[model samples]
Target chain A: MTATLGCVTLSLADRLTDLTLSLHEGEVTAICGPNGAGKSTLLSCLGGLVAADGGLVTLGGRLMRNVPVQERARSIGYLPQSPEIAWDVSVEVLVSLGRLPWGDAGAKIGRDAIEEAIAAMDLGALRNRRVSRLSGGERARALMARVLATCPAWLLADEPLANLDLRHAIALMRRFREQAGKGRGVVLVLHDLATAMNFADRVIVLDRGRLAADGEPAHALRSEVIEQVWGCKAGWLGERGMRALSLG
Target chain B: MNRRLILILVAALVVAVPLSLLAGRVWIDPIAPTTRNAALILFELRLPRAALALVIGAGLGVSGAAMQGYLRNPLADPGLFGIAPGAALGAVLSFWAGYAASVWLLPVFALVGAGGAMALLALIAGREGGVALFTMAGLMIASLAGALTSLAISLSPTPFAMSEIVTWLMGALADRSWREVGIAAPLTLIGVGVLLSAGRGLDALTLGEVAARSLGLEPRRLQARMIVGVGLAVGAAVAVAGVIGFVGLMVPHLVRPLTDRRPSSLMVPSALAGALLLLVADCLCRVLPLSGGELRLGIALSLLGAPFFLKLLLDMRRGLA
Candidate 1:
């Protein structure tokens, strides 16, 4: 599905305005900003989890505002920040819930989809294990598997790599890249600047609820913008292609 | 630990229900033929009482598990949300005010009261997203219902009315007939159906409201359907069996560990465990000798449940820690 976010705007109390730009398909976008910059809120509006005061979101040539919530979910898979697992559901069963919008009729994680998701997330060992008992990193991977089970046209994730360690975090980013390559628009909210630059095809930077920069990560990560908005000095550390920043 | 304990408990309950029935006022061996009165008592009285206990117990267990999962709080109970107390108050007021001249009147009023409380609580809880606020409102509504029930019982002119109210409050299945079972059976089944239909929503809700909404679930609609279903089942059970406590609270806790903390998986097992727990408790009430008279099942459950509740709180604290 071709998903587009057109001139989306949100207003909060105390006269705060959040202006977001439209998103395009076949691209992996990373949203990055300091805390309380409305990065998550932008993702929420895009995923149709929250209503916007202005702007239209159209998917596959139809206005999303007119589509039902469940129907919207069928085309869009979302992961909110700090997602809760209300019970100790097994990983396999939890992942299977991604297929709920299709009702009983749709071909959900039949053996093939479930196996593919588990193997993709490297959660084959944990599939039968209880989610509550899994460690933070393991649980995050399991939740990712759940989102993948739906096989939506777009994937929206909020700080999904927060709990994952280095190796697993890289693996997950690669997975997102792979999904994006498969013609799915993957929108990610990332706290890690290094990974966003290394993995994201494009980065959308927000500053105090407004879109500050939207383009290549290298352009968005300019020294003046980083120094002014983040109050940090961006530093390049040698041939490793790793960028570091020092908060003044 | 979970699987072994469930099996043992189920076995004990299976054995104990028949044993309790056989060891009643008339001591007749299941194998031996004694006086016709003994056989009649076993067939007509004890059997039906056991059956009612099982069904109502299972209903409370499943409903309680569903409620806790729905609200995402272990402290929540049918009474905390006003369904149980509301049903009880409705039945008692009907009884004391002489509105229930016929059997169906009490059940109908009780169901209505239960449904009303659910609607009111849903309005109060759903508007406010926090779990604490929802439970607090539920507690307040329960208190209000409790006060009304007490006042209605006190104002009764009948000489035996106060004792009947006390007995109902204590909760008993001692003399419950097949008719009461018939009334509760179909309603409880309906309630079970409601709980199962919402099972998927409950599963999604575990990931919190935002996650659930993103998955396209309307939280308000799910809350309405769930509360109504719980109230109907609990109200019907209360209308027939009086106000029994602990089944809803204890059964889910006992069965949750067995399912490895999956609320969806716990639903069926919790129901089974709840039925067995109530049956065993009722049996103990029948066999355990009290110097003055028969021990009420509610008192027995409270005696056991108080300590279990403390343990649960400690475990929760440790989890948080």
Candidate 2:
């Protein structure tokens, strides 16, 4: 299914003005921008967690605003930035919450999905451990497993890799790739330009609540565009791929 | 582990009920069937009191657990949110208006008061406010309600009515009969059922509001159920037992480590623990030697619960540090 956003605008003191975008299935799209670039706001609108002031969001010819909330939840899985687990429940129980939208039938279809997410995120060993006791990276992975367990058609995560170490971050990127390979849309708000360049099939760049560039990673991360939007000098480092050198 | 803890609590209740029945100021033999006085004490006085204590305790515990879960704070409780004091003011108003003659009017008025406090709390705190803000709002509402209750007492029509209001505010299960039980039980049960139905939604909330909404659980609906359920249960309990303090606040914390800290998981255990705690406290009220009158149940709970609240505050301060 294709998810399209047309002229979506949200006012948060400052405004995100007339932002338009589309997310295609079987693709890993990275949303990259400087701080306060409205990346998270854009994702929140697409995930239906926040309503836009004026615009339309449609998924497979159905207006997102018109869809039942449960139906929307079944189709879109959202992981907020730095999501908190308020309880000390076991990882397994926490992950089981992803199936909540399915109601009682979740027990029947949820088992395999839970197991798969646990295995995919390499959280099988820590399945029974209290989520509060896990290390930062481990907790991030556990929370990611929770979102993945929903097995939604589209997964939209805001800054999910912020607290991860290098290895876990790469692992998460690979998992996103695998999800895309399985015909799901993977959209992430990322800060690391090198990872976005190396991993994302497409990159959408935003600057100050406006879309600056949208296309393949190479074109979107072009040195001039990066310098213009981010106000920084950037270069293609051979093995490192892309690096921001210095502030303009 | 939860199953085992539940079994142990149930066993303790089994032992406690008999102890409650037999250990009052007037000892009644449980085994002897021929004693007329024993039958009178067991069936008439102790039985209803014990039953009332158990139900009210259970109500407080479950409501406290539900409040904590809904607010996502360990310190959240019916009293903390002003619901208890609001209910107290309602009962006091009923008495001041000379409606206390009807056993039913007391709880009904208290429920309305609790509901009013909840509405006022929501208006002040809003849906998105943090815990500190919510607590501050509750304190303000509680203070307002407390002032109103004092006014009702000072303006009472007769000196005897003023004394009755004072005794009621101190909280006691003394001289309580089946009539009190009849008024409180069904309302408390219904409130408990409403809270229990929101268990899964509460569990989903542990992930925070946005994630919970994404999971197809409406946080607003959950909040409404929590407010209404807590209002009903706590209002009925306070109407019957006067303002018994801290059982709701302390019971959930005591049982939290034993169960999964999942908010939903804490409810049943908290309820059982609450019943046990209040039953024991009521018994202690009877057993403790006092030069003046019998120790009030409210006084006993505050004595125990106040220190715990202080410790909790200290721990929270340390956590913040």
Candidate 3:
């Protein structure tokens, strides 16, 4: 399902204003901006984790505000920035939590989905491991599995790879790319310009809470726009055919 | 096998109970097999005491595990929500006014007091988001209610009543009769049923309220069910055996790691562990040189739990740092 956030405005006692930009489906949309640019907040609005003061958010042609949380959850999967583990459940049991919207934890489809998601994440060996004992990269992958197990039409991940090593980070982005290729709309918030250029199919750059740039990664990473929004310089780099930018 | 633990617990119950029946101020040797005296001691005295301890321990342990699982906090206890102090107040007031002399009077009042505390805490915690705020509010209310109960007990008239009140506050499984069993058993069973029914919700809650909400759980509704269920079960326990400490606090923590931290699986095992712990403690109170010493079960639990609690606090502080 496609998500639409229109003219969305957020205010913190009128001192900070976070402007909203709209997003669509079946594409990997990366939200990038400088500090205090409200990139994460825009993603929250689209994920229905936070309510916008002004405009409305609609998912699958229905107003999100009017839709029930369970109905909304069925169509949208949200992963917050720095997701907290509230308890020490096993990886398999934790992933099984994603199927809760379908029915009881003991339901046949719920169990099958949990097993499939764990297999998809290549966590078969670690399914029985306690979440507390998993390494940072493994934990990120496990949570991705959990979000995927929900089987939502849209995926919202906020910095899904911030704590990962270089290799693991790319693998996580690649996983998102694969999901988008499977026709699931993926909206993620990231600050890394290099990863956004290489991985995101569509880029939505926020500059001081406004939509500074929204287009193909190559077009959105233009030298002047990058310098203006991120307070940095952008230039073509290396044999990888990727745009590289330096944050000043 | 886990089933072996259940068998051992049952056997311990059988042995300790008869031994308790034979002891007391008047000794009746079951080997002699007397008609009136043996029957009286078995039926009226030790039978009730043993049953009381078993049921109360089982209820506290089950509810405690349920609370910890529901709150996703190892430190969470049935008493964390103020119901213990509330039940104590109700029981002390009933005794002071001489109403507790009537059968089931004290239990009824205890239920009311516990229900009131549970309702109050649930309402207050419901306003604040997250488990942390809920626990903080519960602790505050418990402290307040405990202070009020102390005041009421100090002002009681009968000199003997004062000592009785003291033992009750410290918690004991002494001089129980079959009537107390009749009052506690059915209520506790019903409470256990309610908690078990909410097992799926508890599983969802461990992932945090936002995740639980996303998973089609109304956290507020679940919290309400937890408060009511725990209050009913624990209040019945308090009504029969005073305020036993730590079963609810300790059992879940001890078994969670063994059960791989799966809350659904931990519930029954924790209940079993709780029953075993209480039965052992009660047996220790009977034969272990401290029999006539007005031994408080709460004192024993505190002696054991103090260091454990301190260690847990230190670990939490380190983690936060």
Candidate 1 docking DockQ: 0.61
Off by over 4 Å in 1: A1-20, A103-109, A163-168, A231-241, A246-248, B1-21, B99-109, B126-133, B150-160
* Cα RMSD (angstroms) for every candidate in the order listed: 3.9, 3.2, 4.1
Name the better of 2 and 3 by DockQ.
2
Ranked candidates (DockQ, high to low): 2, 1, 3
Interface RMSD measured for model 3? 2.1
- lDDT, candidate 1, at B63: 91
Ranking by lDDT: 2, 1, 3
- Strongest candidate by DockQ: 2
Please report how far candidate 3 places residue A243 from its true position, in Å. 2.6
Model 2 segments beyond 4 Å from truth?
A: A1-14, A104-108, A239-248, B33-36, B99-105, B122-137, B154-160, B314-321
The positional error of residue B41 in candidate 1, measured at the CA in angstroms, is 2.5
Task: Give lDDT tens digits, candidate 2, residues A1-248.
Answer: 12273221222213466566777878988999999888887788778777655656776667677879888888888899889898778998888888877764246578988898899889989999988679988888888888888888888889888878989888788888998898888889999888898889899898887778999988998898899888878777554443433443
**Which 10 consecutive positions of candidate 3 chain A have the poorest summed lDDT?**
A7-16
lDDT of 1 at A186: 88
Over the stretch B117-153, how does candidate 2's per-residue lDDT look in tens digits? Answer: 9899777776764445667888899999999999989
Please give, for residues A200-221, the per-residue lDDT of candidate 3 as tens digits.
Answer: 8778776775667788887887
lDDT of 3 by residue, B1-321 (tens): 345545665676567666666765456767786656678667877778777777787788889888888778888788887888888888888786686568677777777888778878877888644577778878988998899888887887977888878877787777778888888888888887778777777877766676666666676777777777788889898887788888898888877666656566677777767877876687566655654575677788877778877787887788730
The residue pairs in collision within model 1 are A84-B207, A86-B206, A88-B261
